[model samples]
Target: MLIKTFSYTSLFLSFLLVMTGCKDEDYALPVPKSELQNDAIKRTLGPNLVGLDIEFAYAMAILPEKGKIVSAQVEASIAGATGTYLEHRSYYTNGSGEDVGVEVAAPSTTTGATSSVTFNRDTSAATLRYFYRIPEEARGKTVSFTFSAKSSNGESVSYAMGPYTITNMDMKLDMVATDAAACYISIEDMAIYTAAEAAANPGKIDLVYLHRTPTGLTFNHALVSPAADPQYLPGVTLPAGVNRSTKVNKVWNLRDFHLARLQYGVYIDDVDFQELNLEGAPNFAINVRAEAGVWAETADGRYRAYIYVNKVNNGAKNATISMKRYTMP
Candidate 1:
């Protein structure tokens, strides 16, 4: 993974442009005065065709101060398709919080993709759940989101959601149950395992860790190395799907049978950005990239692991990694 940096001067100029854009009446008065609440759209990601992770985040700067939001819902429809709606499989998590699986809502026609999906909480607890599978027709197409937030006093607001482009990246992986404790291995150990070793210890190994090489490999090292081997720091293999990168840029993707590493954090909890925070703070810096917060289940349906790439050193051909292990219930 590569990391990109910017100058403070440019950042300051960007801030000024944003402030200038907000001076208009249409931006200032879209919501009612009675509900003087403000929302900061953190980000909107996927119609992830692979993991089915279609997530959007926004913070209610004033909702808690004003009053509780009585009705909070998200509605998404295919662009230019009129009535065609997609379904949502719901999961909930707060901030960089726990991955609490599935949220069951009262059976309602409105909650389906075609209709507005109402949420239980209103104040910044709105993470898109992956309950509805993306139809084959909707893959690789653009889908729009509409967020409706209403206060108890009948002051309601509708936000014209983003026109996010869906990608065919694979997020689903074969997870397996393991009893091993948290551990770290050098890149040489990971890639150099012999064929006999892999077969001799079937299911013994599950997670492929990535980090900055203790010795460190440079960007040039990556360019010269062939397939994901010890000579060249390998990219994580993302879960199986059309979303997998067709062109191997030495950077890896998440695959069910394979995993990639990003130089994101030194410890498991310290990763720079969530696996979902791709667009916001992009993990890569200079020639290195760091991404953590990847969750997946085992192949036999026995175990799951929350894998994080603490950091990857391209110059030295090494990386550091961490993971949280869970036995599926």
Candidate 2:
């Protein structure tokens, strides 16, 4: 995945610019405020069309604050259309002229040239989350964020977050379960941000692991590289609609299966961004998963591994792990 950065230009405030309220009066004595003229806006992205509403939660936007981010999002829906153009960027600059704002992901939607009936749009929240680690000169400084939008037809629109603060780095991690016997979780990648500096680094992949419980349930993490091939079901063919089998050697998507899994990821716990560099952090990017041995008439198992979103500094964000079993139907 690629990361995108957005820049800016300016204006608008006092609520009347973007809101209408249920207050007693239409002109409520100008809510005591201050003037904010420290931001700018620009046309960073041209146009796009993707169907769906996109959100950028603070805990998920990657950036200068431990849980804050310089991120961007694409929200749109299409009947048969493949996308909705949502761009036109604005930037927040500190006194030093450094970008201290959110980065939105490059919107990518697909449509068949021959048929309007065939469309491909993505609306997943591309949230980036992180914080600045060094003695950022922008700390404590008040900055501004401006965002505009481009229509699929070439029209435009914009909005500002009002005067915002560039706070100190505060990293955090939390999980929210999404189901019963099993729940969905939104993992926050609260790492400090460091300019990619170092020598000889190929950048590694972070894997999230979901171990199975004793009752034959567990989520499958990413696939172990074939180079580090551990024992996996070598020849079991998956049935139709099945992408992988819990057969020990596949990476599965939770939406595609109905099995249980316990999630686990390494980078979320082991990575120290201050130590990350061109060589990336010092650790084995490769790992071999442990296999499960069957017992009794029923077998209890799951793949052991980890999943992670690489520190991709761009306009939008991305951090997630697959929550399904890695087995065949």
Candidate 3:
């Protein structure tokens, strides 16, 4: 009996030891070796449009004991526009949560598709920003970037970012549409035409703008298709071939920042145009107010557009408009 009790006690002790030893493994923080390392992050949001900047933050780090950062460079798949550049400063966040920039390099230089900066500071770590202005040639295409950094110790590191797609939409801003001759808008040409011009190119006229203070009615501002009813068109005479039936739908409170150029952060991307439904929509937007907009589609289904009314002058009978147009498949 004594021997059996001793055997049972030993078995229980072994079980306890096994349970104590079966804990999860300990996690170790990664420590960089004596070499340079690089990482890149895209900071710009929304659709990549033409004539706008695509921003990136590139960080390169090495132990001060190892070596100092010598230079950094970014190579784009396609050459950017004239305003493309790399910042010569390194940035860090302050206690107030604001970014503080410190000079770390001379002005960057660009040659062909690459922009580079040579570090003038003796620091071993830095985060630089690169702004690539989307060129006209990069529209409707994909662009990628390779970010590289070198150290005084002859070690180099590189990081790759995106093959981000550039949008195909066209944008025009601050077009004046008046109650007089310059009231005809052509989405294909992205221009406002006079009465004679509309008559000359009747097929290009998509929408007509007019302001009427008719008695006992509130038709302050309106946009009507050429083939709209006479009541919506007021006193205007349509050109001979300006009878295409356009589709229009009015919307409110959707303030697109790109079109409105206002404080709102809203953006209308390519997907909005692709997913817009104008089936059985009307051909006229009456009493349109400032900050309101409309979705319009051409009669032949070749183009889709969003027209934003930036401002309307009731006394002068004019409006400032902006548009974003997309071509249909």
Q: What are the lDDT scores of the predictions, listed in order?
A: 0.37, 0.23, 0.92
Cα lDDT over the full model 3: 0.92
Say which prediction, candidate 2 or candidate 3, comes out ahead on lDDT: 3
Judging by lDDT, tell me the better candidate of 1 and 3: 3
Model 1 residue runs over 4 Å out of place are: 1-47, 58-68, 79-110, 114-133, 169-329
Q: What would the per-residue lDDT of candidate 1 be over residues 96-199, giving only the tens digit for each residue?
A: 89655443233324444544444444442233332234455565566766656565555666666556555433332322211111211112122222224434
Reference-based TM-score, model 3:
0.84
| Decreasing lDDT order of the candidates | 3, 1, 2
Task: Name model 2 segments beyond 4 Å from true.
Answer: 1-143, 146-222, 230-329
Best by TM-score: 3
For 1-329, candidate 2 gives per-residue lDDT tens digits of 12222212122344454465544655656542221112222321211112211222121111122122222322212112332233322234589988554334443232321111111222112222211111234334443333323322223333444233333322222221111111112112222211121011112211112222223433232222212223321222222221211212222222111112223221111122222222222111212222211100001222222222222211221222222111111
Candidate 2 lDDT (Cα, 0 to 1) = 0.23
Looking at model 2, report the run of 10 residues with the lowest lDDT sum: 292-301
Error of 1 at 230 (Å): 23
